[model samples]
Structures are given as structure tokens and as C-alpha cells.
Target: MAQGTLEVVLINAKGLENTDFLNNMDPYVIVCYGSQKRKSSIASGQGSEPEWNETFTFDVNLGDLVSPLRFWTAIVVQRMTVLEKLCNIPLESVMEEGKVPAAPYNVVKDQEFRGQIKVSLSFTHKTHRHGHGMAVQEESYGGWKQSSTY
Candidate 1:
């Protein structure tokens, strides 16, 4: 097992079924890993095609190298109802190289299909000291990217 950081870029959501009766639904995302939970800002009136471009980080201790790491994602409306739409990310796919492809999840209301949310994820391992107490080789492009918003 390796202790490191997991980076989740909450890029955007598309084709989300509007839940509000009279207006466009206000939607946000809640991401969970172990005991850590992070949320993206609500996409005010973006309706179905909402873009967040938000990033969340979690401290992770990866146990199995062969299997994928899993996390829970839920799309919420008005911060009250938890839409039946849920997503689980396979971290191993995005751990070493490319992005996690946007996959569709079933959104349900009264047991009927509502819509979907598209998300992408990426991960990078943290540098650790060697047995000889020497610093590990650092990758120039492997740290957190600074953002102006939070």
C-alpha cells in the first residue's frame, strides 16, 4: 500500500435531468473517499449542461495495486434531495497516465430514468523518502496546480 494524494477535477456535468418543477434545478456535487467529503459549488442556473471546473483533493492510502480505487459521487438538488444519480470512479485508470473517461450514470425519479452526469478524474502519487533517508526524485509537473478560486 502507498500513501499519497488523490486529485479529482470536478469538470462539469451534462444532461442532468431537471428536478425543479417551475425552474431549472440547482445542482452540485458531493464526492466522498473514506471519511473525507468535498463538494463543488452549485451551478446556479446552468440547467442540464452545467460546468463547475472545480478541483478536490483527498489524502488516500492505496492498498491494492491490481484493483481500482473507488470513491462515491452524488449529484444533489437544492442541497436537500440526493438525486438517485451516483458515480463511482475507478482510480487506477487515471492514476498513472490518462484521464477517466466520462461515463453515464442512471438518474432516477420514482424508479424511472432521469438523466446523467459526466465527470473526469486524475491521480498522482506523492514523493516519499528512501530507506537511506535520501529525498525521492521529484517530477516537475506532478504537484497541485494553483487555482485562483479556492
Candidate 2:
């Protein structure tokens, strides 16, 4: 059987208001996994120039997100819209618990932006149900330990 992967793309960001101030925000991508006891994989990207716009794209295994369709839909509709309206998305954009919003990007209505950037991510999915929650283990070279076991 062929493996399934989720492809995420960051569309254009537009500023709702006009301003001369430079919005130095970058679009970020995140993958959420599990539910009731969820976890997330967050990545940061650069922003567009003061006069140019950019897009970000990423791919992930469908199984990575507990409810891939539901979660992604919410991100596309709610968070993205809000971020565009705000004109700037901070690196510390992710909120507390499972309340993290979509990655934000810098945009301006009239001001020229020569500082835009793009990012991409890709990962495979591995489905393993652990009932209560899922656990991830990572091994590092230094000491062959799972120290940063996020």
C-alpha cells in the first residue's frame, strides 16, 4: 500500500490596513498530533520583503495529526484569516495548550515589502495508538540518550 502524506501550503498574506511601519513577521508551520493528550511540531520561517510576498509549503504524514482534516481546516479558516487581518505574526505565536494558532506572516496593505521569505516541511506518518497518549523517543549522538524527548 502507498503511504499517505498531508501537503500544507502557506498562501499569500495581505494586510487589512495601510501602514508605513515594517512588519517583520514570518509565516510558521505546525503539525498537531493526538487529542485529549496532544502534541505539536512547530517550525519557523522567514518573512516577505517590504514590497514582495511569499508562500510556504510543507508535507507530513496524514497520521501525524490526530484529526488531520478537522485540525487543518480550523487552521486554514480561522487562524490564517486572523493573521492576515493583523498584518503580523510573531514567532511566539503559538499559544498555551491546544490553543495554538496558525503560523503568521508579515504583510502590509500599501507599504512596499522587500523582506518576505518562504519555508517548507515534509515528514512521513506512523500510526501507533497508545490509548491514553503517544510517546516519542529521540536519540542523540553525544550520550545516546533521549534527553530532549518532546
Candidate 3:
């Protein structure tokens, strides 16, 4: 099973408590790792990654989450970003091109001020061969769509 944690570190700023802005900001950086059979029968795409690690940072204004509540929201985003990246459907072109998904889980605020939010992400990949223990059919399109959980 994949395991990880998301954290949002809050900093001190002036007059910055906007829920809309906090929610709008992109948060979450996912890191995944797993091993799978080299051959795949299900059209879900490749099922093996010797190892993986990646980091995705948000472009939102850090000073916006000046309030305690907004700080918490930022933390949530940091965590969710990881899930999105891990389970995000592999681009057909990219996958076909032999580009493995990068596990992104390390994020740091670039701002030079105190009270800034810092998010730390980490996880392991636990993948399996397609239809290894069961039977599955490939789609006519030969590609898999995004799934919430695998």
C-alpha cells in the first residue's frame, strides 16, 4: 500500500486571510514507489517503477494565508497534490514515449520571510502487474483513464 503525509507550515504575515485565495492555490506534492511485473495485460499502462520521486510547488502568493484557518487549508493542499500526481492518468503520448512518471513529494516555499508555509511529502510505490491475479481486457483505445485508487 502507498503511504505518505502532507503538512502545511504557517508563517506570520500582515492582513492576509482570504479563503477563496487559499483554496484557489495549488497544493499537494505526491511521491510514489512500487514494483510490478514487466508485462502488463490490462490497458491501464505500465505497472512497474524500480523507483520514483518528484516535487511540485504551487505558484500562489504565500502571504495570502495569514490567518490560522487559511494556514490549515494550505496544509491540506500540500497533501492532496501528492495524491493527484500519484494517481493521475499517464499521458498516452508521454507513456508511449517511454517517460516514466516522476514521484514528486518534496516542496519548499521560496519566499524569504518568516511564517511561510512549508510542506513535506513522502511515500512509497506499491504497484502490481495488470491482471496478475485476475483477468482483464484492454480497451480499444489502448489507454487507461485517471482513477481515484488502484
- Which candidate comes out best when scored by TM-score? 1
What is the per-residue lDDT of model 1 for residues 1-150, given as tens digits with 9 covering 90 to 100? 456677777676666666676677767777777778887787877777778878788887765443333333344555675544355555655665635665555545566665665566665557767566665633323434322221
Question: TM per model?
Answer: 0.68, 0.21, 0.17
lDDT of 3 at 19: 26
- Estimate, for each residue in 44-131, the C-alpha lDDT of model 2 and write its tens digit: 2223221222222223222222342212201122234222322333211111121233443443345745222232223333343333
- The total number of steric clashes, by the backbone 3 Å criterion, in model 1 comes to 0
Report the poorest 10 consecutive residues by lDDT, candidate 2: 90-99
Candidate 1 whole-model C-alpha lDDT, 0 to 1: 0.61
Which sequence of candidate numbers ranks them by lDDT, best first? 1, 2, 3
What ranges in model 1 sit over 4 Å off? 65-80, 96-114, 131-133, 137-150
Model 2, position 89: C-alpha lDDT score: 34
TM-score of 2: 0.21
Could you tell me which residue pairs clash in candidate 1?
Answer: none
**By TM-score, how accurate is candidate 1?**
0.68
User: Please, what is the whole-model Cα lDDT of each candidate in the order they appear?
Assistant: 0.61, 0.28, 0.24
